[model samples]
Target: MPVSRRTFLGGGLAAAAVAVTGTPLLAGCASDKKNSAAVNAAVKLPTYQKYGAIKPDLPGNDAVLDAFLKYPANPVKAITDKPGDGQPISFITNIPGAIPPAADNNQFWQAVNERLGSELQISMASNDEYPDKLATRIAGGDLPDIINIPPTTVQIPGLLKAKAMDLTEQLSGDGVLKYPFLANIPTVYWKGCVFNGAIYGVPVPRGMSRTTLPLYRADLLAAKGIKDPAPKNFEEFLALAQEMTAAKENKWAWTKPPLPYIRQMIGLPNQWKEEGGKFTSFYEAEGSSEALEAGRKMVEAGVVNPDTFSAKASARKQWFNGGIASFDIDSFVAWNQYYADNTAGDAFSVNMLDVPGFDGGQGKPWMGSALNNVTAFSKDSKHSVETLLKIANWMAAPFGTEEYLFRKYGLEGRHYTLNGTDPTPTKTGVVETGIGLQYISDSALALYWAGKPDVPQRQHAIQEKIADRLVYDASYGLYSETLSKDGARLTKQMTDLENEIMSGNKPVSDWAPAVKNWLSSGGEKIRGELQQAFTATSGK
Candidate 1:
């Protein structure tokens, strides 16, 4: 369950203060390791004395609201004639599809360049390769003026040490706050952008996407005479899977991917700590053990196909074509892509199921974090504060506004026509009228929950239902460099172990020593570092 912000802060404040100020405190603490308790007691005294109550400054802005109401024209001038005369500002984005067409370059770039009063250039890279490329560029002292760092790779320690330009002061200031769209962002997300009390990035608000719910074939459930097919607990869920399999009369109960279902099973976030300072894999969490056991039981019972994990996209194809009965899928896939793929008729009727809670374990239901992505400025950018501010303002603007939609979707009549109120494309007019790949980073373009008529309203409905049912994993912070590099490796190892055990190739008895080894080898260190960091910054 989600803890209140106040409760989280109250519990963690001291540890957080220590982590944030630990560099100076480390010297003192280092000398008294022999008397650690005494040192801890001594440290508390000074922390309490020096650190007074720190309240977050919540600034209000009527001007920003006005600007939101009336979005002003682009303030910068076009650099069409002398393309390279002005300060050339480069924007590095992970959205592989965001790049505008070369033919429309003169029109689009001219508009962008004019809006920024700078020679604007846009570049695209794949999300998978972005972190490595970004790291190399930053390390080599080569950086674009505006660089986007997905929350997944925004390593707090590395970014701070690298001297990334701090935008916290600017963003919080009166000038930037005056842009109304900026206020639309939730303050909870600001935590990811804050490192050591300094902000280095302008958060690009991403709406809820990629969250998973039980995407089951409702028609199959009804045919099986199962009412209230949605399971509320792990046991019930497993039973439902069994029932569905039996009702299939030979068809598989569920499709499977290589991805483990434990994270969803126990409502635990993707990461957690066990014994040592090293970060243990989520699979190593107590909840995951229960989840694994559940899976083992299901497999042993023949509720799930032994070949389920080997099933691919073709499995989903078969399921939609009436081969398999039910499976788990993201709400978006079940509604938008699946339905659209079978335009001849409804391939399957679907419904969302609330992720089941563990019976004896944690009561939390697994859900995705609210944040989707973030945008940051390069540490070496020479652009003035005013220019950067303007860029940020432009970024915060909503879709369907003059700035983003017109550039992204093109002129409505000429490029595409609204098939109906729905945002997702339905007809060739909107389909052929290219929107490019702007959806990569643009939240407004990806309408996950907010509804439109022509599009799959079921997807939106399912998302909202899931949101209402599950709590966000507030314990897990955005992924940092240290976490990602280490966590990725650990996750892979753990997943391998799981595969071995689940396939009956290895026994669950091996889990203890394997866990000990994991912790002894750097898992504990990572955990301590993260716990320490979380405590220090969270003001708990």
Candidate 2:
């Protein structure tokens, strides 16, 4: 979750005041240049009290916003345009749900076309069928001028070999650096877009928070006489879950989707380190037993609904309508929707809990990619390199600004309204506007974007709270396509195995053999590839 300047000041004013006043003498003493530099460095560093609020020194600029607001009125001429009449630059995407016509209207295209003086057209494929279609298209050498690749389906190595065009030279060109927003993209994120020392695509970073955690009905927890409502670790969390389960007067203790997500909540690594610097399936991790044991404890304690394994998405309807479940784990984005839909005049409240780390185990939480997806240009596209650069430059703006924010979100009066200087729901919901609109096609990176000054201040406050409660694993940055392709398959297998074991179709003893098979079947190779990539790229 991201915050605006107002929210940061409002939330931390008391503490900020205390710090500033308490250190008045220190501030006065820092008159020398060296001392002032030290003071500035300290101020730029993140302080726990300001959790989720990016330090003011963190690079944030209005170039993207400026482009959105001023591009049409004063557009830059292309440094070099292709001679003669240009072909319609074909763009392809497989964003989920329907593509709004406004997104592809000539005015929007014109914003891009003006940068290169080329015709632009967009083609969309069904989201579910995109990967296969893209593969076929690429194999047939009939690629679009630009293609949006979903993170889930990108086979990085194969795509690089067949469809991706190296843009290293263009990315490093003087024109690219002249655009401040494009130039400011963090090198950490840019690393993902590079291969074999060459850049191929512009990375669209995802939000920072990734893992789901248990969100509890605070009112219910209080009613159950649960003291110290927040549990610090797995054992204490289990006890609380059991107590809540036993006291179910009108609600179940917990409910969850019948998926591996629950296992993941207990720190089940989808991929894990094996012997000799190789990777192994999650089942092979020393932590696997702890996760499985945790699962078994939940079932035995009856904290989890017996029907949970069979529960469908709608099974939680009772929980949603009647506040039946005391707690459940879900992605952070769902937290906002849950509160919006479930609140009862402030009687009910939601609190995200940090999924406790294992005992004596290193806490390694998953980190989602900053870019939800990547935008790639086809090798044969007619659009000049300058046009693509302009579009990318325009995309770097923070949401909630006069430019990109409204397009990604929506017009404030129409989609939302301010309530006493706070952005709150108008009749339209978050999905109808704001980050919700982007979720249909994008992964809602606006979660990390600054909020509007007038938006309900509570919205930003709650998001910061959620971010504070999240646990992050820096190792998640180690993911690579070389590992991901094999890793995805292994994860699917592990999920299936867990389901089978829980259903009594397989014995727990099967774990040892499964581990052996996983290691031998390309798992070790994937691990080695990831470790090597991480070491080379991250210097870790």
lDDT of 1 by residue, 1-540 (tens): 234432221211111111221122111222112212122222111011111111111211210011111112341221123222368777766643233354244344455566546666666566556656665665566777776655444234345436467665565534334444454444444444544345545554322444555566766777779755656666777777777775346676766531344456566544443232234456456665666666666676676655665665556556644646476555443454555444335435666665555664333434444344445666667876556655565554554345455444444454434444212333433333332223223323233211223233444444544544443333344222234335445545667777676666777776667777777765665566555544443422
Can you list the residue pairs that collide in candidate 2?
Answer: 204-371, 205-370, 205-371, 206-370, 206-371, 279-527, 422-455, 422-456, 423-455, 423-456
Q: Which number leads on TM-score?
A: 1
Q: Which stretches of candidate 2 lie over 4 Å from their true place?
A: 1-91, 94-130, 136-142, 173-176, 222-228, 246-250, 257-270, 273-281, 310-322, 337-348, 357-364, 420-485, 531-540
For all predicted structures, in order, the TM-scores are: 0.67, 0.66
What is the model-wide C-alpha lDDT for candidate 2?
Answer: 0.46
* lDDT (tens digit, per residue) of candidate 2 on 190-213: 444543335657665444333455
lDDT value, residue 23 of candidate 2:
20
Question: At residue 52, what lDDT does model 1 achieve?
Answer: 13
lDDT of each: 0.47, 0.46
